[model samples]
Target: MVNIALGASLSTVILTVPVMEAISLYTGQPFIMAMTSVQTVMVTITLIVAAINLNDGQTNAIEGMTHFVLFATFVMLTVLGL
Candidate 1:
């Protein structure tokens, strides 16, 4: 799980930075602002989930459901341009 999380996060950063930079270049927006906003949100959510799951050291069914739902929502939002 840790490996999976690490890989996913690394890929996100690798992909998002360039994409954000491209968007900024084309739109004349600040790249740093866009990158920072995305980084902050991702970090905040990761910290919150880590905190919530730290005590038990085990993921319950509800937690699994939450993760799945969140992932699905992310995919849909990305696809739909939310």
Candidate 2:
């Protein structure tokens, strides 16, 4: 699950760069730096979450809900551009 999540998260950045680049070409506004910063922040947050969760070696229903909420929020925010 962790691997899957990591792969998906990484792919977002991979897939976004080309699209962003194309938009920048058409719009004459460079956004690669903003995209890069967003990716860096995402990676840092994911790493922190993984480190904290793995160190505990335990998970409960609330943790499961938290994970779900986090992923859902990420998806919604991405879709809504929030």
- TM-score for each model: 0.45, 0.45
lDDT of 1 by residue, 1-82 (tens): 9999989988888998789889989999875553344445655775687678666788888887766766676566557655
Which window of ten consecutive residues has the lowest lDDT sum in model 2?
A: 34-43
In terms of lDDT, model 2 sits at 0.72
lDDT string, candidate 2, 1-82, tens digits: 9999989978887897788888989999866464445546665776677677768898778767766766776666667765
lDDT of 2 at 65: 74
After superposition of all CA atoms, the RMSD between model 1 and the true structure is 6.6
Question: lDDT of model 2 at residue 24?
Answer: 89
